[model samples]
Target: MEIRNAKETIRQGAPSDESSKPDHTTKMIVYMTIASTAAEGLTGICSVVSSFLNDFSME
Candidate 1:
């Protein structure tokens, strides 16, 4: 009986551990995606501002 209970506990715990691993990975991917998007937006804004300044200086 005790061995059976132990086996059941291990089976349940294994799935929980596997599920948690994917949750962590998903969170990391979401964070990285947000960071990359923000970086791209900032770069685009900088480029536009630089072009505007260059045009202003030429006039």
Candidate 2:
């Protein structure tokens, strides 16, 4: 039927339409910023724990 053919055409076109989406540069930048912030936070936690352990060991 014509309707079935049209439906198949529409279905095949859907993925190409979705693939033509724009880049998410802004979202990527935001994610990178968040990842950097998390890394800094983890570094601070490690430093603090090391310092505490050193002080306790000296006592």
Candidate 3:
């Protein structure tokens, strides 16, 4: 009886493991996209600040 219960648990766990793989991949992709977008925004802000400083120094 214990062996039968264990088998049932394993069978349930198997489908969850398979489903989690794609969910994990999707979460990783989303994180990467957010990181890249933040990097682009930071670079744009840095360039604008540098240009402004250059103009101020020239004056």
Candidate 4:
């Protein structure tokens, strides 16, 4: 059916649309996202460790 063909066309076009972005910019975005996520996770771990240390110190 025509609707099915149209859906297929849209699916094929999606990757091209995404690929149109500059590769450097995409890499920067991905790297920044990874870096920020890692930093946030580390911060949370440090906070928990600090809290535990503080509790031990209070005893």
- Candidate topping lDDT: 2
Quote the RMSD, in angstroms, for model 3: 4.7
Judged by TM-score, which candidate is best?
Answer: 1
Alpha-carbon lDDT of model 2? 0.93
Off by over 4 Å in 4: 1-22
- Compose the digit string of candidate 2's lDDT tens values, residues 15-59: 666578988999999999999999999999999999999999997
lDDT (C-alpha, whole model) for all candidates = 0.89, 0.93, 0.89, 0.91
**Model 1 compared with the native: what TM-score?**
0.60
Q: Which of candidates 1 and 4 is the stronger one according to lDDT?
A: 4
Q: Worst 10-residue stretch by lDDT in candidate 2?
A: 11-20
Quote model 4's TM-score. Answer: 0.51
- Residues 1-59, candidate 1, lDDT per residue (tens digit)? 99999899998775565666645777899999999999999999999999999999999
Per-residue lDDT of model 4, residues 1-59, tens digit only:
99999899998875676678666977899999999999999999999999999999999
Error of 1 at 35 (Å): 0.7
How much lDDT does candidate 4 score? 0.91
Off by more than 4 A, model 2: 1-23
Model 2 per-residue lDDT at 25: 91
How does candidate 2 fare on TM-score? 0.56
> Which order, best to worst by TM-score?
1, 3, 2, 4
* Residue pair clashes in candidate 1: none
TM-score for each candidate, following the candidate numbering: 0.60, 0.56, 0.57, 0.51
